[model samples]
Target: MSAGGAHLKDEGTRRQVVLAGGAAGLISRFCVAPLDVVKIRLQLQVHSLSDPPSHGSAAGPVYKGTWSTMRAIVRQEGITGLWKGNIPAEMMYVCYGAIQFTAYRSTTEALAQLDPHRLPPSAESFISGAVGGGMATGATYPLDLLRTRFAAQGTERIYRSLGGSILEIARHEGVPGFFRGCSAAITQIVPYMGLFFATYESLRPITTQWEQLPFGTSDAAAGVVASVLAKTGVFPLDLVRKRLQVQGPTRTRYVHRNIPEYRGVLDTIGTILRTQGPRGLYRGLTVSLFKAAPASAVTMWTYEHVLRLVQEMELAAEA
Candidate 1:
């Protein structure tokens, strides 16, 4: 590997990596949309998971657990309910994947030139992943906010369609509305992605040697481990980001009524701690872990194989 970077030396190869990353994102999003929807529902709830607001009966929380939530969504909102915000979600994933991989590849290549010997592989991976994740999060933040809004709404439709949601935000919250939780998102994603890639790269060699893993390939297993670990570490920030994004007039439309208004990041965290306790910050973490495992597996598997395929095609074209 020269200072210029290994496989990404050429424009053609870099383009291939970007496309592969996009495909990986698309596939992963489709596979885990239901878990994501459930996760958001649980995150937005004001009450504890174990207890529900007494509505004059022994009814449990609207979303109790992963399986129960899935059942509830299916029963009330039909099968498609699980896919509430999939349209914007998919768009965000594709763009995010493309931007993230390319930025990561570029950043690593640059680091190779600047301080290849000085920086450890872990540090390089962390820096590159943080750059990539930050770029992706910034570029696709609006879509992310829209996806959250769509997912937050229940049987009572809030912003109806994607275009309508955009218009509603524009009408009320203005252009800045699209970037509502972007700071929190970037803060959460930067370190999370850094840790994710650092962990993945660190574990990949060991995981690959294990022949009995579920995917028969080490990357999938490594991805699962990395994602679960990384997600757990940054989950509270993620929950906060979701809460911030759902602020404004749209909050009234969501099923989780009576959500306390947050002034900013610290205030939100403080409010959660004061009102709901530390456990409240981890709301929906169970479903998030479930979503993270398969999403990471699919993402790593797809990105690797697709990149290989594209490289092979490029070589064949040259040959």
Candidate 2:
């Protein structure tokens, strides 16, 4: 390849794949932001609707299941309430997904050059995904905090805008507050992403060869399966992460505490187990699954399609 050809090849490098992945993540997230809002609220409720109302319940706790939550949000705050934090939430997830794919692709490409024979394709996929998710979590954690806070905002409207919320968090908890639950996030997301890529990649041949479908179709099918598996496995850690990040003086269940609300990750885990049992850790599992299944399919398909198109264009230009 000539110098110009090499440069053109760089256009389709893993770094640029981040752009395609980000676009895919953004559109997929927008498709399911409302479901995400419901999932976050449900996770933050502090009490289980499955059990009878108790002291820790969110006031009357009228919002119970996913359907009831959507209905209550619509009834109390209008249809728009269901999508209150759509912008920030989409932005956060988009960046997260983009960074994830970028790191995954980059890591795999780099590793293949070093020790291609030692690690199988499935193992490579898992490692790349794990690294990608951890890096993305660390890089975009503050945005995660803001997005969660935005989604958690309900009828009381404690947080009027994104800037106001950031200022308040900075004032109260300082810069570190932005990364409160980062450890939990990384812990959960690392393995979650690892299994996701492993499963998806492993299924590729099954869908493409056995089913004789197109590449995008195979990946979408695989993505749905990966999504369900990853979400279900790490849901408890996700609940803990949300609880740690969302502490504040609000009318909701996450009312601010004068002191450090949760001692640490384990303490938070134990508290939930004691208070709400296993069910507590899975507060919004239903809504999350509902959102994840389609979101994963769409995101995978879109990413595959977009990346292929971009690479094709790059190749054509080089030609």
Candidate 3:
């Protein structure tokens, strides 16, 4: 193919990946959204430091586990609680997934085209995933922050509703409020995605050799493995990110709410550790892991299938 033709082809494929990734994200978000709500609730729980827990604030109900959290949400806020902030979550997912896959695919393809003989697939995936994850997080961060706040709000809404939340944040906290935890988000997502993709690439050969599997199945398996490992390593960062996001809309003039007014990523980290203990950083680790496994599986499986479908359609069109 001519250079111009090749460029067009590359762009076309990138767009296809974007669409496929968006579809995958939409599907996966719905599948795991309840768990997502539960996880955020768990993460946002601020245990009182008092020995008798006598902070004068009503003691937040302790969620024993996923099932209890689900029960609590359903009982308190109805079934709708399971899907709190779903709109923003879905939007963030679609944008984040589409941008991530598009950038990752484009970068990887370009690198491979430039030096096919040098870099391995795992290295390529890692580099592309890292860059793409950072881009995706940065591009869709406001939506992410909004989603976190909405989910954390539940029935006792801080901002009353979505439009209210958006306007309130814009009016009170300004533009940067939308990106309260940008650094922490980037720190959490970039390496997590890089490691996840690299692990997936690394496992391809091993999985295929172990047993004959369908295209998307292997991808699903790899995604599950990668998600577990990556999530475990980086749960603390994610917890900190969530706290930072909620700080923006929930802060009050009378009393600074949202845990010591997080200065930055490191400050958030230290504060959580020093005050809440090491366990504080892993508050929602259980629910997060539960969400990660099936969510990752669905996302990767659907993404791979949709990507293949797109490729086939593109090839047919070209032919």
Candidate 4:
């Protein structure tokens, strides 16, 4: 291929990769958000002691299955409740996924150029994924907090819109409230992203070689496999973060109608362990797994195909 042709091809590939990643992210979030709602409620219930009158259920909150939770949320809150913070959630996923994909591809390319023989190990992918997740989560955490609150509220009140909800949170809790779960979010998301990329990159080649699939096909397949593996590893942290975000001062009352209450992430984890045990930490794993598998598979597949199409279109335009 001519130099100019090669340049065009490279640009097309880059565009395709970006589009694919963004699409995957968007789809994954939408698909799994309902399960996400369930997870949040399960986490929050651990801390729901304070709002005794409002929240009810002192017997440590009944452990409903995912379907039951979904049914209850829908019956109590309506269709809108299931979606909760959908707008911001979608935006976060799109932006985060796009940046993540771009970063991963660029990093992989650079590393490959540096040491072609040395494939990216889990550690390297972990670091890269961690950086991407941290950056993305940090940028979008405020929105995440809002989504959690809205979902947790359970149709008791109405906000005029997303802006109204933000205003309410700001007025009630001040600026810091928006960042309530930030530390835990970063902790959870960073490793989740890192491990995801690392595992996917490391495994893609092996899986592809063993399966004898095309080169890029392995990368796409790897994305799905890696997502599941990483999610399983980091799900507990996610449970913690959601709990911290949604629990609020109300959670303290649940912990101890007195005793100064639990403060911050460590306190909450310790309390849950004392009261609830390991099962407390993994309330929604089943639903999460169900949602995650197809979500990841579809996301990665869509992203790859989208990129391919975009590249083809770009090349055709040039031709």
Best model per TM-score: 1
Q: Please write out the lDDT profile of model 3 over residues 1-319, one tens digit for every residue.
A: 6432232223356678888899989999999999998888777766632234323243533455678779977987899989988998899899989998888887777776754364666677788889989999999998888888777764566756678878998999999889888899898988899998888778755665756676538878888999999899989999888878877537432111334577889998888888778988998898899999999999988987888788888889999
Candidate lDDT values, in order: 0.88, 0.77, 0.79, 0.68
Runs with alpha carbons beyond 4 Å of true place in candidate 1: 1-12, 53-60, 115-117, 214-216
Off by over 4 Å in 4: 1-16, 47-56, 60-63, 110-120, 158-160, 206-221, 247-262
- Give the backbone clash total of model 2: 1
TM-score of 3: 0.87
Cα lDDT, model 1, residue 15? 89
lDDT of 1 at 80: 97
Q: Estimate the TM-score of every prediction.
A: 0.93, 0.87, 0.87, 0.80
Give per-residue CA lDDT, model 2, range 272-298, as digits (tens): 888778887888899999999999998
lDDT of 1 by residue, 1-319 (tens): 5643432224246889799999999999999999999999889888776786444222445667789888988998899999999999999999999999999988887777764354777888899999999999999999999999999887889877899889989999999989987889999999999999999988888887887776456889889999999999999999999999899977766867766788778999999999889998999998999999999999988998888889898889999
Residue range 23-120, candidate 4, lDDT tens digits: 88898888878877776665566533232332344544533567867887888768766787778788878877787777766665554454435443
